[model samples]
Target: MTDPAYQRLGLPVTASPFAVLRAAVRALHPDTRAVRGFRAARKRFYRQMLCAHAARQAAGDRLTG
Candidate 1:
């Protein structure tokens, strides 16, 4: 089965951990940095993205390690 974390991020399962992390960081970037409430939303989203990436990494290790 594919890692749902990668799927959620629209990345391939074969993507490296660095790629996943970069993607997660890139996702938080916005064209305009002045939106109201963006700070709070980004914080929550960042947490979720970290959790998803961690889950993907753990799952990959289980499958291959």
Candidate 2:
């Protein structure tokens, strides 16, 4: 299954945790710096992205909580 989270981040399902965090940070940057309240929004968005990624990972038979 292809994940939109990975698609949006231009990454792969096999991407490591470090890679996911880095890509998310990169995507959130600049906007977070220039816009007011953007940091909070970015954090919220990143959480959803991570949750989606986790769901995809779990689909591969790796259990997560």
Candidate 3:
């Protein structure tokens, strides 16, 4: 199954949890420190990270159960 979160993070659904987290950190790192829209961008980044984490959990569950 193709996970949209993995696709957004440029990872495979079978990726390890550590890999997912590493990718999330790398992806979430902001290129700019602009004060404008910083709050909204931060919120989006956190949301994406959560989605990636959830995808990793779902993948692990499928493997274990």
- Winning candidate number (lDDT): 2
Q: Report the lDDT tens digits of candidate 1 across residue range 1-56.
A: 54454466786556666777677667554653357667786666556666676677
List per-prediction Cα lDDT, in the order shown: 0.65, 0.72, 0.65
TM per model? 0.55, 0.64, 0.47
Ranking by TM-score: 2, 1, 3
TM-score winner between 1 and 3, please give it.
1
Worst 10 residues of 1 by lDDT: 25-34
Q: What is the C-alpha lDDT profile of model 3 across 1-65, one tens digit per residue?
A: 54455467776656666776677657654554345668676657656666766767787788899
- Write one digit per residue (lDDT tens) for candidate 2, span 1-65: 55565578976677777787788878765757578767787777777777777777777665543
Candidate 3 runs further than 4 Å off: 1-36
Clashes of each: 0, 0, 0
Q: Once superposed on the true structure, which residue ranges of model 2 sit more than 4 Å away at CA?
A: 1-5, 62-65
Residue 61 local lDDT, model 2: 60
Q: Check candidate 2 and list the clashing pairs.
A: none
Ranking by lDDT: 2, 3, 1
Model 2 is weakest, by summed lDDT over 10 consecutive residues, at 56-65
